[model samples]
Target: MAERIFKYVVLGGGIAGGYAAREFAKQGVKPGELAIISNEAVAPYERPTLSKGYLLPDSPPRLPGFHVCVGSGGERLLPEWYVEKGIELILKTEIVKADLTSKTLTSAAGETFKYQILIIATGSNVIKLSDFGAQGADSKNILYLRDIVDADLLVETIKQKKNGKVVIVGGGYIGLELSAAINLNNLDVTMVYPEPWCMPRLFTAGIAAFYEGYYANKGIKIIKGTVAVAFTADSNGEVKDVKLKDGRTLEADIVVVGVGGRPLTALFKGQVEEEKGGIKTDAFFQTSVSGVYAVGDVATFPMKIYDELRRVEHVDHARKSAEHAVKAIFASELGETIDAYDYLPYFYSRSFNLSWQFYGDNVGDTVLFGDNNPASDKPKFGSYWIKDGKVVGVFLEGGTAEENKAIANVARIQPSVESSDALAKAGLSFACKI
Candidate 1:
């Protein structure tokens, strides 16, 4: 009698899928026994740098050049890693359908794979502004940046324009970063947001207001509480202006729509349970079907802080969640139950010469800690969200190594009246006083 080898099939080669595949290899899974199917022709690569480094005009002109360079060996997350790890790499392959009851997946190439385990890590796709009719009005000037291809096209378009005025249509992290980069390139930039402050969904009103002044001082116009109704273009078919809901029109050359993105789960539609644009998964990241798991932006699970189920799309969430999913799979194979995944969510962004970091969940009743400077003259201070005397979240500006570590430690412990007093004694100021 010989040990039976199990087959594992993973779909999507983005961060979640790529890391999952690598983790499987490290778990002693042989190459022939595991297979990675992706529609992308190239192997997995880092996407965070796409909007910053890879999108710059000085970057190499080809797609391959966008691939990150690693040590002296110049090693990247190339497909050869799959071969070396004994994993089968199926590039330029799309999974069209999956028969969950039979544990079978059908690819666009007309090949079927039956696996004992399946992982779906399909990332997300940018929500196009065309859906809102803003596309037809200035089809030539409106652009969306999601992947390397989108960045490349945008770089080329920017290079051809003179006296370029770029209007970014969102106030999220990506949009803010893009705005900063465009301003750094010395182009006229304006950001339009439907909310009263930027990143309101991620941070508190106090923190969001802080960034408004931070960006305004950097020569980037912040059009808060305004929305674009339509794009007005010149007869030559180039974007000339943007008409806002306020009956005002502003000049623009390029309109970069960074409104947000939706998870790429169309292939799993009707086959898996989804809520609010992500697959509904258990604490272990298992879907409704047996042996099928989902992670990253496409999966939603319970959050300890909010005491509700939520989907997080940050890089840290994806990496941490996928690691939990892998461990659960390993445990289940041995007929053992694993503990539920419970880790605090963390995220950070760098823009306009400021580094912002947040830990824990920023939801629920919060009492801010630190200075509240609306004038934006001094360096912005950090704020901690207090709930029932425990610090649930911390948001800070100007990345001080000591302050960040202190915030991290405070976030892990329950804040009591005594602990709060201790923090104040430890030199953490209250927002109301400042």
Candidate 2:
């Protein structure tokens, strides 16, 4: 058979690939000129929803509703959008071999395709307990959430294990969010993490205190200073309990692991430079090799704000970097230039009717602001990170639109703070003024 050809091909059909394809379409696309290779059966939808509203039984967002661009508050790009734009979407296909030198990709079935330009957006893979040689790690009902299929499995398992005991292994966003989802389902939930506080990467102790306490009030058990070392399975090959590193065991009808993730960059190994465990790229998301780019969780690019190389694994970067990569491709073709991506790192999570938004880096001395009493009827809290005598980051819980926007602006501007105490005293008002 003849080899398939495309002017441009985007690998990995998650948020990054979807957004990149949208950008390509926006610029212009002739029939069969562009294609998106995704292992997912459906077109790209907001992946974060897998843990949030998608878990809700009532009116959960299904496919086509939460497609790409919707997360950016722009026009949703459904599967039909691809057809309308004359863009080919190769779904349920996995490229087993990639040859950067020849600009060729071979599918798992041995079909070959060639591209003039390529964008890599494979994202990441969940770090499984199996990687650590945990006993009974492959037991049934022990789940993870990374893609729609995983979410579907979790939802199905929730029904089969309704009102059951759930042991959440890890206290990051995945564990925290899933805790709420399972708890709301009336399942008994226990969270175990080996960190001093939850979200140690972003939330300071003071910041984490509010959430930990809030979760406590929600009737979820919190176990810190330890991790799930092994799992116990029942006669039916379903997870029955979790053994902790601290020599404690807890009954678990369902186990969900969210320890962390490793960037998916094995396919392009040795083809391009790698750093920070991700494919190295410039501010424009162009990889070390010309006509090839990497984005999303797999792209480690320069952060001009911090004057360092950083690889961010959040949805915001996933969407922005994809757009940037496509824009950079179009620019190169048209002999035009655009400003580099100056991203102010942002992350957020929502659980149990409580939401938080954070902006900029979470480094330096953190100052807590607002009341953090989980018992309070109206709980509102935030934190600011002051680094180099400037407010480098802002975190606010239960912020309104204008209020959230204020914190974002503060993070982007990084206003100087005379002192941590003074900044704490200024609080939300200080951010509002900015």
Candidate 3:
């Protein structure tokens, strides 16, 4: 008699999907019982570095961190790993439609597969300039830093026009990082944001001002309180300029759009309950559909700190949610009830010479701390959110080892502002003294 094998099918082979498939395989699932499907030809790869490391000439080619098999050097995730682990790899395939009632999925190639369990890790897509009508919307000089292909195109374009003007249309992490990198190439760079400060969504007004000055000091043109309305092109169909909502026009040879990313839940549009343009999932990362799970950028789950539902598109959230989704699957397999997934959300980014780290939810009244210099190299700052005198969130910039630990401690205790002198102690030495 043969052992009963539980078949698992993972859709979307990006970070979230790849990690979930690897976890399911690690649980002693047989290759014949597991299948990983990806829409792209190449295996899953790390995406966060695509905007930074992959764009640089000195950095090594980035590959997917999650692997199934051990190779000759035991470095790569080989096809044999899936074979030995009883997991099948389906490359260059896409799940066009999913039938939850029949527990089956149909691929674009017309191949059908049955899965006892399914994981949706489709991740998110970069918000393009077409949505904003920026210069790079149709020009060959325009590029996005979303995937390896985009990075490669950007490298080629940068090499061809080493001294051209590069205009970035977002002050978010990706936009800021890319602007810094392109500026390093000695190209004239300009960053445009609708908000008055950088990273307005992630950082407090003071911290955002700090970064605004940080970029401005590096000779990068920072255009705030302006939104890109349309693109201006030359007769040759090349991007020549960009029209701003403030009745200003900026000349540009290249345009990069990094406005933000939206969840890639289009395929599951009618299947899942979506709000704010993302799939609505429960505490366990389970969607409205049974036996089906959604994780990463696609999931909008409840946050204990915010006391409301939120969707996070950061890489840390993707990794943590994948772990929780796997645990939920295991519990379901054993017919055991599981607890809700509760983890503090965190994200980081590097621009110029500064590294920014943030934790918890910044959805409440914020108390600012540290040095508030927009031009200081050693400036460090922190923001704590208090509700009913209890700390619920913390955001730190130019953080120290002690500050990192302190932020974590604050999260656990839900501390009151009076308990710690994070503000007075750090004082003028740190940025955001207020």
- Tens-digit lDDT track of model 3 for 281-334: 888888899878888888888876556788888777776788688888888788
Candidate ranking under TM-score, highest first, comes to 2, 3, 1
Return the candidate ranking by lDDT, descending. Answer: 2, 1, 3
Candidate 1 wrong stretches, greater than 4 Å: 1-6, 56-76, 135-138, 304-307, 365-380, 418-434
What C-alpha lDDT do the candidate models reach, one value each?
0.74, 0.91, 0.74
Per-residue alpha-carbon lDDT of candidate 2 for residues 111-158, written as tens digits (9 for 90 to 100): 898999999999999999999999999999999999989999999999
TM-score result, candidate 2: 0.98
Residue 185, candidate 3: how far off, in angstroms?
A: 1.8
TM-score versus the correct structure, for each prediction:
0.87, 0.98, 0.88
Sliding window of 10 residues with minimal summed lDDT for model 1:
65-74
Best lDDT goes to which candidate?
2
lDDT of 1 by residue, 213-327 (tens): 6678788898878888887778877887888888888889898988889998887789889987799998989998888999999998877656778898987777677768888
Q: Say which candidate scores most in TM-score.
A: 2
Which runs in model 2 stand beyond 4 Å of their true positions?
none
